[model samples]
Target chain A: MSHDAHVYSKSQTEYEYTRRVRREAMRGQVTTFAIMIFLTLIAFSAVAAGFSEYFIVPILLLLAAIQVVLQLYYFMHMSEKNHGMAAFFLYSGAILGFTLFLTFLTIVWWN
Target chain B: MDFNTKYTPQSWPDHPEQVTLEGKNKFLGFWLFLAGETVLFSSLFATYLALKNKGPSGMEFSTQTLFELPLVFVMTMILLTSSLTSVYAMYHMKNHNFKGMQTWLAITVILGIAFLCLEIYEFNHYVHLGFTYGQSAFSTAFFTLVGTHGLHVAIGLGWIILLLIRNAKRGFSLYNAPKYYTASLYWHFIDVVWVFIFTVVYLMGVVG
Candidate 1:
């Protein structure tokens, strides 16, 4: 309650501010957690539903991609404001990985 | 551990874990390591995709029979829920709630152990089903990719256990805050890889 307390000493206002940020972050986490579970369910049901392999494969991969992004940004806290370098390296690595895979798919053949 | 608790507003911010110099470096460096791990896993994933089902096509012990959806579903849920529990641990960390953080981390570690046991069972089941490694290129790739992931989970379990034991006495301080934070990040990365394994390796293996 003292205004002239130590500079780094926890003030009522600072406590409220931190609490509010954490509360909002928790909401984001809960929502994404539900969405991730839903996505996983959809992935499982798509297979169980016995659709054409052609139809199921791409859809399964797409859903997995979405879940990966969600896991990275939401649960992993990659979306936070100060994570620029992390995001850069992550996307760069992804792009490089995809490129390598694409090259193999284009060139590698089976008899 | 010489935890330097004193700080000014200029040094400590809303998030104490990330406000220190070492914390900032550790946070950035761990993510970069994870980025490289992404590439590593991707290469393994591509190898698996190319080699899956390439083994002479007529074997009775096909992937479909080998993959137990119910078991995989349970494993996925357990790992996913563990990720959430680690989030709660980090949440408590940000709030400076030491006991809350420790409780959630303990829960996370327990769930991780459960997942590892299930993986061991799954591998045992596969071997019993006569799908041992070296049967074919497909089998080799499958075991390597998934087994690597299982190894990561095992290592993560050990990492958490060591951190919990070492830090239990010290509690939350700036010196150890980044240590706990990075451990959670590693745990989350393991869960992320499992997401792909569940979908790409298990679900798609069953479907396609």
Candidate 2:
């Protein structure tokens, strides 16, 4: 069976509007990148400044969590519509992964 | 429509990557694969965390002394920038600018190569300092964890390069659009893993 994809060309104004919208989205992505860089800087500086391990470790992990969320939602487009199934699969994996972390850290350390 | 159906920017669908049955299936299936990958990496991370700094008696090497922050910092920046470049490439793809997408992807490949080079240098430096793979339990765990990530980076670079060359002659099409989109998604996932690596392994290592 053949699938026929109908092509409908946009008018000049419509094309221009779509282009502008894409450009705006790109700008937002760039801003997200900048924030990731800033977070990296703070993580590095916090360690270099010789802060208490207790204080620095949590902050570092927090920054990493924030960065990963941004990467997932923005860069990976998980924030977009029609991603319900995708989100479900990913979060399930994430929950299992978190369980693994807790098990290893607690059980292995205790033993 | 035929897989080879041609279209100008004006005729191209807004979400060309997901416009067809195959594209939609590929999109969902790839995310499932990514979810599995997350589980795989989590296991590795767990193993590394448990075995970290646990070596034979009188062992000298540890995370604090072995890792150099400056080198890791630079590598982080390069990889982060490369991720954004791939985002730019996708933006160009959405705009149906084939040349623009290719150029940005080329830039991304270059940056990826630079990151790989730094990683090689870092590994070699560690080896010279008596940190070989079989040195100790800690060394094994460290190498296994970070080396797996390095392998992922190498694989991602190869995948993107092959896509760039194979599709060099073919402009944007519904068939190939999902391919590029998935490749970028994988690349971003690599960056996500690195974020955790730097924090859990490098940063925490330094802190302790």
Candidate 3:
């Protein structure tokens, strides 16, 4: 609310440091968007050429995977050194997800 | 809705201690969500492949007969641009620029609506050519895959509208920041899903 820049006392310097760190955290979201744009164009081309359906599916899937990682690493900031254990729990869902897909596909295809 | 419950608190620290438990949990929770979404789409993708070659009356009325590139190209661009704008919004949020974030998010929302219109038009054109979803398994799969993604877009539009309205008065704080963050994540997630939908549903149908 104050028009003037609020100068921080040395004792309360952590608040200023926190604000700066938070600012850095936000800027990294841009890279995630850049990768998303690259992936989207590839998707558009696949839709355009009308020739790469089978090949394109996997490519797009891989890009989705990459974007997922991008979101986690950048936006979510989950890859910090202390959070390694938590990463396993997150990846466990990814493993379970793959299992679910393969199981459902097999049953449907075999039936 | 004032989301100020203890479970969903009124505010949180803009930056917390390095090993804060809550932030770690949130990060993992979102990852799990992305994983679940992956499985959801994979199942849809599998169903689509099974039905791709199955056309009407044993004759080939599948993707090749129905898919159009020009319209799809424009839709693709619309979605891609929306992704860029949402990123800009997030960038502003990081810098504590609430107005810039809102401005960008508004643009992203409009682009999302435009893409939805393009999809609707594309579907109508396909149906006019006798490629309706009820026509066959292929059409069923086609409609389900793409339609599900469309539904996501619709829901996202509604979600962003709520976010815009709710946050209009309240600027960027820790509580609202994560709310915006997750909403954008969902938006980007939908855009990514469409990428696959375009490939597996439209491209494959035309080629195979």
Candidate 4:
């Protein structure tokens, strides 16, 4: 099976173009990292500022959700092609996780 | 080609990590494992949330008095930056720049070690303050959840460091490309879990 593989060298132009594209993608990843940092700052400051728990909790969760989405899509390359099965598995786990959260938060805390 | 196949920048596949059947299977299998990790962590988070702050009748060690924001904030930034460094490493990997990739990964390992040191210090401080793992349900839950994440960080560091050493002379190949790719993905996933730990565990713990 290994012998079936073929290696094709790119032309100079093709190599340069791919390099440029990857650099741009790397730049996008940096932007995502910046946004994640901004979100973390907001989360920390909102608590440090002494906001009501009711108001802060939802905002914190929302910010965390947004940050995770960015991490998964940009950093983890879920935004790229050929991730349908990957998405399916992760989302299925996520759905079940959400269910676990709901159940535990409700049932376990009951007096 | 096989592991020993040599290629120049011009010959390197665009997605060298996914260029082979083995690489493709590894890619898919790793994601499946990550999905399982998600479920496992969610169970832990749920348990932590349900048991948070619940203890004996006169428990005084609540989240408000226990968690320190500045420390957590620093840890968060370190882990987040480490995630980006791994991204940079992957970028170099894609560009077929072996030295660049190794340098960035080394930077990532240093950051990860820094983060792990902070966590150890934080846990030691907690233990010193009578908040040992057996102190209360809250303490137990807190330690378990956060400690589990710390373990992941440790494992990730070991994995990347091993890869760096093993591939030092290997240069780049379809075989090792997928290994590096999956390791970075694991590192990013660690950062993803930290985002929640900071928000739900530390930030919200402070608010209440």
Give the candidate number with the greatest DockQ.
Answer: 4
Q: What are the per-residue Cα lDDT tens digits for candidate 3 across A8-31? A: 233356646755665565556555
lDDT of 3 by residue, B1-208 (tens): 1223111111223332211344445655765676677777777877777666575567657566778766776787788678768877876665556789899999999999999998898889878887777888878988898888899999999999899998798765435666777778778778767666665566555555
lDDT of 4 by residue, B58-120 (tens): 987999888889999999999999999999999999888999999999999999999999999
Answer with 1 or 4, whichever has the higher DockQ.
Answer: 4
| Candidate order (TM-score) | 4, 2, 1, 3
Q: In angstroms, what RMSD does candidate 4 have relative to the true structure?
A: 1.0
**Model 1 interface RMSD over true interface Cα atoms:** 5.8
Quality class of the docking in candidate 1, CAPRI style: acceptable
lDDT of each: 0.84, 0.93, 0.68, 0.92
Q: Please give, for residues B84-199, the per-residue lDDT of candidate 1 as tens digits.
A: 99999989887777789899999999999999999998888888877889777888889999999999999988988998899897767778888888999899889889988998
Q: Clash pairs of candidate 2?
A: A3-B1, A4-B1, A5-B1
Candidate whose lDDT is highest: 2
lDDT of 2 by residue, B1-208 (tens): 5577888899888998888888899999999999998998998999999999889898899998899999999999999999999999999899899999999999999999999999999999999999899999899988898899999999999999999999999999988999999999999999999999999999899999
- Superposed on the true chain A, the predicted chain A of model 2 yields a TM-score of 0.92
DockQ of 4: 0.81
True contacts kept of each: 0.55, 0.80, 0.20, 0.86
Between candidates 3 and 4, the lDDT winner: 4
Q: What DockQ does candidate 2 have relative to the true complex?
A: 0.75
Model 3 spans > 4 angstroms off: A1-90, A103-111, B1-28
Error of 1 at B78 (Å): 0.3
What is the Å distance of residue B8 in model 2 from its true position? Answer: 0.3
